[model samples]
Target: MTMINPAGIPHGYNTPIPSEILTADRVETRIGTLEFTDGFPSDDTAAKVFDHLDFLRAVEVFLQCVPAASMEGLRAGLLDIGCDAAHKMVIADRLLDSNPLFLTGNTDTVYALAMLDLHRDGPTVVQIPPGCGPGTVNDAWFRFVTDMGAPGPDRGAGGNYLIVPPEYEGEIPDGYFVSHSPSYTNLLALRGFVVEGKTDVAKAMFEDGVKIYPLSAADARPEMEFSSFSGKEFNTIHANDRTFYNEMADVIRREPIDVIDPETRGLLASIGIRKDRAFAPDEQMCGTLADAAAVGNATARSIVFQTRDKRAYFYEDRKWKTGFVGGDYRWLDGDGRDGRNMDARTMFFYQATLNTPAMALEMVGVGSQYALTERDASGAFLQGSHSYRLTLPSGVPAKDFWSVIVYDPQTRSELQTGQPLPSRSSENNRTELVYNDDGSIDLTFSPEPPSEHRGNWIQTVPSKSWYAILRLYGPLKPWFDKTWKPHDIERI
Candidate 1:
């Protein structure tokens, strides 16, 4: 049998499979199309295939959003659709082979690592071929067989080693101990390692000291004869880990740090990293804190919203007044217009409004619901507004606070104005808000503030549309299971 190169094929299939060699009858039973002979595909198989497609689709979608052509080679082979389970797996394997990390594990690990990077604040070092630049390692990229383990301690969790990128040949300086923080996971340091000519050299700092481990076999492996050494093992921490913040100080102490390239810098800024400073938490890190709030005035709009799932919902009035909602979402549009431009800002507002309550409720035990308010919809006073409101009819679970935030429809960024963007249940804003004597909440939205409830009001910008997101901390069960419905916005 001749070896068939998967990557050599345009979409991983050969034409006719050399029909002359097999009888027609035998050919039908032997190597026919995979789609015809299957029972229902299992969820696991579907998820695996979906992950592969998601990566390809994400890169394609991101390229579509950005104006650069750096990814032309990867894009050329992604046009064909997989026909069956085997075909999908084959195609996925080929794609995975192109990236070193995925060749060793499932895509979830890749996604998890990406999420860690997004949420953690720090510089992430990724291992790559000697000449490859930082652009090649993106949100979808992962590493395998690293000296460190994955970000946290679940599947092969060990230290900051796995999360940070490996040093390139001639990159490691001398006398550096490759230490990392538990929080950001990306900010790393190499102390006490010696920088020799074209190579990093080091002697055991202590009788039992740290040693370097090779991820691939091509590198030199340490033998007992080399040296007996030991040191403190690295630890992986979650976003909420208290040690994370303290570690930030240590990360900043390292000198002559390897800065990420400008392109990656721009990408980082796009994701909410402040361009003004070298070290600061990005947007994802803000979401992890209970009291943390995102920067209110940042002009960086979500340029694109990309997701693996294809299903999404959009509601619009006759005038094209629109609202959209979806999960695992990514930005596709940036212009904010309703047509085909794929507005990331609009989608971000809709998604935040839709998911925040659900997420908050999950943290508590409540169920909540959301709906777009129509011009003449009628219900209790809580149900009359054009703005969105989530209520913990049973009450919130937090010992301290909870609130709702509003966003501009076009930019998906927080609407900046004199009126407060979030309405909290705390005494500071509660007495000024419209609420039932029974303690249930109502959020008001309009061009002008309501006559009675001024504090709980969200102002709409002129010629601009808006969407509201409700965040309920320590929620009740009714909010999560969808048993409780959210009040709508009424344009008075």
Candidate 2:
């Protein structure tokens, strides 16, 4: 007796069947069985298959660029709240609340966020605060337009800067650091350090210092309005469905066609989005696009948290990770020979917004740095009910400031608990943080505040999983040299 396949085929692998009996009518089929391998029945069927594949390919490209798309959506949302180009949104109260307004937003500093549409407002002027850490100017695509503070032209002292819109051939003004923007819409974000956790001092700086308006209306410009968004719930993440494609279409229609690469433009065209044309997809095409968007979203999420490449991990023995897994901001491999790394792009966008070459470069004493982790030292995903501890060595590597912020793994936004801001930082208010003899400080994560180290603890919720980001505002040489490394979180 011999074991036989359920399909009534011969038991041995070497057995052969008669070709005549292989006809479709005589063969039993299952879910994955190929009913017809000869080819598609008609040209229409072949064309439809090709179109769906192309649609999916375009979706892959779209998902890879979600960071830029998400930044655009945030700008739009800000505009919706207040249409004035000169207005700014700042955290009015203690710290930034657990809102989906921005990804990995820091509560350690008072943020003055300005959204501008130069196409409508013409040339705009931005006033930067001196000594403010890292302020950034990004365009519609979230491409880095300029940096403010120590590394910027302002050099940590306040200065007036002018930004001319695309296609603006106006007179180049004198005595001002000028930048020509490549996109019509722009984002101006200023991070002001607070004194001893007194946000009022930082908030005042924004109110008295920051200004933005059309150059022509400088004298009569409306006073810069500051809106406090503390404790508010809003969305800043881009949609992962058909709405995402619509947002990209809107950006293409509003900005110059050259803002994105030609290859990207072609991909958009394949999906029925072209500059200066109505982006109307038929019902069948829309269905295919929706399915593509779902897959695209899943792809980016997988890259963000489950990346298997060894290069993604920070150390051989720790779970600390970097969003730019390749160590280069531009996603270039160490050899610099391989083409763009799509997984790196996906990781960045899924976790944060904005893109700039400065982030990719290694600055000796200045510039920003980031570390992300979703797991504990035991190589297990973080659980809300579990308490954990992390230790920051005596000589923390941040020349400016360091913050450990907890974020919801799903939204990539601040993790909401009883506390508004689920973070602890080496800023003004945390001055009393007890440090060890060697200067190492311990931080705790638990639903209930720690019995002793209250200042060094971040609150966690009991029902939600979370991740964290360690931001070094002005990363020092030790960080770059790998001489100073923060210990991973361990279960208490």
Q: What's each prediction's clash count?
A: 49, 8
TM-score of each: 0.33, 0.87
**lDDT of candidate 2?**
0.77
lDDT of 1 by residue, 163-245 (tens): 33333333433322243322222211111211221111222221123222333311453321221111111112111122222
Candidate number of the best lDDT:
2
lDDT of 2 by residue, 46-145 (tens): 5655676667766765775685688777877677666455555554446667864677777777767778778888888887666665678888776678
- Candidate number achieving the greatest TM-score relative to the actual structure: 2
Candidate 2 residue runs with Cα over 4 Å from true position: 1-48, 87-93, 334-336, 428-432
Report model 2's TM-score to 2 decimal places: 0.87
| Root-mean-square deviation of every model | 22.9, 6.4
